[model samples]
Target: MSLDIKRPNSNKTKKKMGFIVKMQLHNNNNRGGSNKRNLFFVFFRSYYRWILWFFLSLYFFTSYFAGDQSSPSSTTTTRLLSNHNPSSSLPSRALIESSAIVTPGIFSGMKIYIYDLPARFNVDWVTKSDRCATHLFAAEVAIHRALLSDSSVRTLDPEEADFFFVPVYVSCNFSTSNGFPSLSHARSLLGSAVDFLSDQYPFWNRTQGSDHVFVASHDFGACFHAMEDMAIEEGIPEFMKKSIILQTFGVNYKHPCQEAEHVVIPPYIPPESVQRAMDRAPANGRRDIWAFFRGKMEVNPKNISGRFYSKGVRTAILKKYGGRRRFYLNRHRFAGYRSEIVRSVFCLCPLGWAPWSPRLVESAVLGCVPVVIADGIKLPFSETVRWPEISLTVAEKDVKNLRKILEHVAVTNLSVIQRNLREPAFKRALLYNVPMKEGDATWHILEALWRKLDRSYRRSRVLSE
Candidate 1:
């Protein structure tokens, strides 16, 4: 059997058939000789479809051309605003949009260009010592690794980048003497990285390193010295003075160490380590120890070169409350110190050489209330984490009244503080993950950088374009 297919323009045949029917009606209904009226009806009925088609085509053509003439910048602005995830929290949107920077939703649109430096600048140190990536001063390695795997914010092209991240591992040089990292070669290593970038790429010279970012996760940040007096004497390097530094050292008062543009970031603590401690902890979450401290607490702190360790704060605590039953303070390092943190009610976070300490993050992450006794110390992620609600701050001069202050809090708002500390957001904000999770330390660092987008020369140029 054979089959026949209809022509592609079958609608034309239907229009012709309707026109013929209208003609037959016009011819048959003219009982009187009113020819003009009959002819007018025939004309309108036959050509109405063509008129409608003409107007519709004209409307669509005009719309297409008008869209082409719209400004590219306005289209880009709409695209940027529409890129925000609907599932993101309202507070995140408010935090991103509150700044009247170059555009809206730039927090989501932020792009960083990480330099592809030689392995000697970064990964070689980690290979040399496993402690390079897990130590207390390992924020440099953590931020670098996290950003390398982050595709949402990292861009391969340098021309489109908002900021340049120079991944130099300055804090990985460990000394054989004290097992602590030596900052002796930090300046030279970072300075050599700057020279290499300037020679190979134009980004460093374009802004004179103003739009670049670095991590100085040490006692005095870019000063790269453990002692404050020595750190002040040799201030931030000249090459890194204009760039941004992510540091663990900060203060409410003016100081020579934190003189450059910087963001206060928590000292690095491995996420797996925190998870292991939480796993080994009691299922009911029982804290037995009253007030715990397990670091240096000298009976008589010697004055060396017009300075004292912890500015004599830890020494005073030992002199005042050494033998108290409630105060379980020690001066030795324990292998399972994190297990101890999980069982403590109050963890002493007194000043060491710097105001900030790794114990502040450890105690906060382990569900222990941090009794921060460092005067004028600035904590990290204050914008996202509620530091005051979860922790207590005591003046360095009030070492004798430490018991009274903690007892008063325990009687009044201790439960309130413990409830706040148990929130997962607080724990996530202080720990750095390898691939990076939402609300983690690296993410908060990106949020802090997002607020400073006004410094992005490319964004300004993009808006003007």
Candidate 2:
């Protein structure tokens, strides 16, 4: 039994023991590797829902932000040209390239017939509007001047015309004696025109002058109708209100061009401003001042609540932030206003007796960003013009916070806004387009009137029914 116990070799036994040790070590190593992988899997599984939630939240937020900007927002440079007439394209790229101010197509083969209004109705108001420095509303004469230009859509024969241009200077009838505009005189002018048109043509009787249009930048101009006294509704003459009315103010709740029959038009741009903007470079020049405003600051305190209360805004502006650092203010029109504007970065176009003004144009020409203070004043050619892209709008309430708000604007952003003002689309759409330029303010007006006429006609029909 003792001899048998010693029979196994020590080397063999040692070799077998070493082999068993190596196998156990290898298995332990494999198990160790597998456990690490298992630990990773466990960690991933525990946070699986959190990871999914994080990604889903990101996706939802991204979609919401994208939806917010599906079309250009109010403050963006992109224009919203809604195809009101689904069948036809707008006066867009191709039309712009061709420089067709009033194209024959979207005009839908329709002709604009200018009413041979007595020179008195249109001419008498010219000097009156420019009587004061800050008080001006010359759309009557401006529109008349636009009509004088060459156009393919204008028909020499009124019989073939689909729209009538009534060149009436309803705003000019003011009494210099009391320094006040007589709504009575304005009414008389309107009344005389209505009588003449009704007696002369069967057209006004047909659609109640739904096809006629007039441009009046004055707030009191459009409201001077005897319709309130008449046995009719609408508080204005049926024929005049039924026809298209173009005014400087856009969509007002009452007076100064109301509703679909009203198309917002730009205040006439001065020839000097247009010329300067044309000759000047678009980006990066010497801009000296932070903000520039030089006009009448004396606003009547009694009439402070009115929407077109030009006085109240000026009062607020002058009272709160006048004669401050980097903020220029003058009681009288600065003789060097253009020079100052040229050297400045921002020009304050506050309400001056009315909402719209030629100052807005002057600011753009001098390469200054306009700070529009007039509430509800729609910049010219707004249908195709992106106003906020070119200017800063401070509401009447924010006049007190003017400096702080303007200071927040980065210099980098101001450059882009100033540069955007120089775009051809904006120039053509916002300014009185030079002879034969497509996207002219007048052409846009015709296009707007053309689209609006059909809908307006239908509405009038329904109202009458």
The most accurate candidate by TM-score is: 1
Weakest lDDT window of 10 consecutive positions for candidate 1: 77-86
Clashing pairs for predicted structure model 2, backbone only: 99-438, 288-343
Top model number, lDDT = 1
Q: What is the C-alpha lDDT of each candidate?
A: 0.85, 0.63
What TM-score does each of the candidates earn?
Answer: 0.78, 0.66
- lDDT for model 1: 0.85
**Clash pairs detected, candidate 1:** none
lDDT of 2 at 72: 24
**TM accuracy, model 1:** 0.78
Q: How accurate is candidate 2 locally (lDDT)?
A: 0.63
**Runs in model 2 lying further than 4 Å from the true structure:** 1-105, 123-135, 177-183, 224-235, 252-260, 276-284, 299-311, 433-436, 453-465
